[model samples]
Target: MKATLIQQIEDICNTRGVRLTPQRKRVYELICNSPKASSAYELLDSLRETEPSAKPPTIYRALDFLMEQGFIHRVESTNSYVSCNSCHDKKHFSHLLICDQCGSVIELQDSDLIALLAEHAKQHNFAIHNHVIESHGTCPSCKK
Candidate 1:
């Protein structure tokens, strides 16, 4: 999974004319290998193992680039980041379902839900640009 994700990131960067610097690639790899969303500080600490000089700014810069290139997603509620599963696909809005027990996140793209939200916004004369919905609950694994 990590290898495939890295290859996809490389392909997407090449297609989008985005530069995947060594630091950015490493940061992305760290996120991909993570079992759940990771905080910037967590990334910095891990990076420092190999890159002793790595600082918060270094990690943040790489994260900014990765987010801009659609290689990752930020969970606003948790203030952490996750590797985007839809990086190689067309841009679309997605909500996150977080497992409170395990901190796992499932990205969901529901057309009906999106459309309903859009319609609701339109009723109030608001133009929808982007949105992030986060719902927390126990996952199936944790429920068992």
Candidate 2:
């Protein structure tokens, strides 16, 4: 699983023509391994264990690159980031399933749902440059 995620990250960087530096690769690994949304601070803390030399700006720059490449999504409500499961297309954004209790986040890829939301916006004469659906509730584990 880790290998696949790393490959995906490399593929993304290659497809987008972005250079994947070592630091970027490390940050990518951290995001890919996490099951929930993570903040830069959290990632930095974790990276410190394995890479004590990694600095805050290094993680931040790597995160910026990932986000720009559509490899990750930032959850505004919780101020965290999660790898996007949506196909890495510039036109797609993953709908976020957020667990309020534990701050867990799940990425849902629903093309039909996205179309419906777009149609709804058209009905209201609103032009959506970009948008993400976020639903907050307790996840199964949190409920238990």
Candidate 3:
């Protein structure tokens, strides 16, 4: 399953006329392996230890490409990026559940909410292109 995701990312990058370099692969692998969303700085620190020659700009560029290709989703509230499990085309939407106390992030599927949001957008005469909802609160672990 993981390998398939990597291959999909590589295919998407190729379609976008971008080559998937080793550094980008490493960064993508790290994001996929991590259980939580990660910031570029966190990735940079880890990458530096593993590949001392890697620079911050390289990681940032890779991140930008990954984001543009919809290989990852960025959480505005947390200011971090998580690997997008559903990567096929650029026409998908996602909702983010973020824990305020522990900074834990979870992806939720709310079909009803999505429908309502779509209706609301239509009523307001707005063309919905990209949609991201971030709900912040304490997770069960933090509540305990």
Candidate 4:
């Protein structure tokens, strides 16, 4: 699954005529392999295992590149990153359902919700380049 997703991302980057540098790919792999959202420092630390000179800026730059390409999602409330399941194209919309107890994240795509938000934005004369809705609640396993 991880390999497949990475290949898909590589293809997307190629289609966009952007270079997914080795460091960026590593950072992306870290985030993709993680079960939960990962903070910048955590990613840096992990990256340091292989790249002893890896710095915070290194992770940030890689993350910035990935985010710009819309291959990853940033959890706003917690300030972490996650690559949710299903990666066929550059993710344009992110509606996340977060588990407050287990720290799990589920990314959802709802066209109706997107339209709703767009309508609200239009009413207020707001031009949204991109948006994410982070809704926190307990998961079924956590509820148990």
- Give the number of the best model, judged by TM-score: 1
lDDT of 1 by residue, 12-53 (tens): 889888789989999999998888889999999999999999
Please provide, for model 2 over 23-53, each residue's C-alpha lDDT reduced to its tens digit, 9 standing for 90 to 100.
Answer: 8788878888887889999999999998898
| Model 2 error, position 98 (Å) | 1.1
- Per residue, candidate 4 scores C-alpha lDDT tens digits across 108-132 of 8888999999999999999998777
**Cα lDDT over the full model 3:** 0.82
Q: Write candidate 3's Cα lDDT for 30-131 as tens digits.
A: 888877788889888888888988887988998887787777888887779888867665657778888877767887767798899999999999988877
* lDDT of model number 4: 0.88
Maximum-lDDT candidate:
1
Better structure of 1 and 2 per TM-score: 1
- Each candidate's lDDT (Cα)? 0.89, 0.83, 0.82, 0.88
RMSD of 4: 1.6
Q: On TM-score, who's better, 3 or 4?
A: 4
Error of 3 at 18 (Å): 4.2
Name the weakest run of 10 consecutive residues (lDDT summed) in model 4.
84-93
Clashing pairs in 4: none
lDDT of 3 at 123: 98
Instruction: In model 1, state the lDDT of residue 21.
Output: 90
TM-score of 1: 0.94
Q: Ten-residue segment with the worst summed lDDT in candidate 1? A: 83-92
Q: How many clashes would you count in candidate 2?
A: 0
